[model samples]
Target: MTELAVMGPKESEFVDRMGLYYERLGGTRTMGRMYAWLMICDPPHQSLTELAGELGVSKTAISTVARQLESGGMIERVPAPGRQHHYRIVSGGWAQVLQVRLVEVRNLVETLDLGLAVLDDSLPEQRARLEETRDFFAFSNLDGMELLKRWEEHRKNQD
Candidate 1:
């Protein structure tokens, strides 16, 4: 009969939407669940067993998502010596993570650009919409990169 930190209704909804977003962007549902658990759980760090239990996923899925998050710079694995490894979400300036996702969106825009071109002006309206979307992504990507660079510089100067 113990209570742990849990997401409220709004946060739960947010996590659910984020899970769908990640799934749509080619990540597995388990990966999304892992992220959700990390965001809501107290301490922000968990072991494979804990994550698996919370996410109701197999240990293998937890391991895979942990590796993926680490590689994507969204999380980092902690060394625990003779114990199982633990992971924590990347802290400080969530902006960097946003920038990474924007880059991925920018890549999608490039692919969409190709598809629209192949459509060959047959659907001018659709082409215009796609072009606008592409332009927005390109601009956002550039802005994100610049912001992250400035943040890095500021952090260095603080030292």
Candidate 2:
């Protein structure tokens, strides 16, 4: 295994900010830090041991978060020479994440549609609220899909 470079103060601060951002988005700080580090880490890939050492966490913790990230399509496991696992960010990882979110948005739209169906006609205000929320999500879902398509095209062009 190669020696991992020590993180400088600025890099560490950026990792911490990413951690907080991920935490706010319902993910662990460790996961966010690891993700941030991976984005800029040397050689573009790191093993569990390397990640644990860099983040001051246990290998088990890193492994757990790695699995979550892999399943979520943000990162992917790569084959290395030894038994230790390695991971790196995917090319369209953010787009994959957005795709997952759009699915959730679609689900919410369906739920709102159900709510509108069961809602009483007498409650005009409640119906209006549901209608507005549903409309917003529906439009957002459409826009998000278009955005993802455009992003993919742009990425392909870059490549």
Candidate 3:
């Protein structure tokens, strides 16, 4: 068995909590734990072998989550020496994730509109339900865009 990286009790708890959080969000527990570890790990970047060992999982699992995270803009593969690939949390990755979610919200609203179109006026109650859901998402998307814009401005000023 590969030796695992030593983490204090608090750090271990934090990693587990993050794993649960991501799992609740429809992601794998390992994905969140690995991301949390990378965020607080001393080196701030880790190879697949290192991550697998630290998380007590297989390298293949780490590799799969790494690809998922990279595609989702949550983390990035970094250039490193040797054949082993290293990864780190992308700077502003959370913001990028929110941006992607905003797009998804837009898509949901569009889908709801399609559903509404298929229903007849006689189905008032059903139409009201769809309309309410669609309106909520539409409003959220508008507010989310403004929030992102303000966040960008705040970040710029902080620099």
TM-score of each: 0.59, 0.95, 0.91
| Between candidates 1 and 2, the TM-score winner | 2
71: Cα error in model 1, Å: 0.6
Segments of candidate 1 deviating more than 4 angstroms: 1-15, 92-94, 97-141, 147-159
Give the C-alpha miss distance for residue 104 in model 2, angstroms. 0.6
Error of 2 at 113 (Å): 0.5
Error of 3 at 138 (Å): 0.5
lDDT of 3 by residue, 1-159 (tens): 333457789999999999999999999999999999998986778899999988899999999999999999889999988899999998889899999999999999999999999999999999999999999999999999999999999999999
- Which residue pairs come into collision in candidate 3? none
Clash count (model 3, backbone only):
0
Against the reference, the lDDT scores of all candidates come to 0.78, 0.95, 0.93
Task: Give the clash total for candidate 1.
Answer: 0
Residues 1-159, model 1: lDDT tens digits = 234465667766776777787899788777776787787788677889878776667999899889998887778887655588788888652665677788797888789789777877789988888888888877888888888889889988998
Candidate with best lDDT: 2
Q: Candidate 2: TM-score?
A: 0.95
lDDT of 3: 0.93
Between candidates 2 and 3, name the one with more favorable lDDT: 2
> What order do you get sorting by TM-score, best first?
2, 3, 1
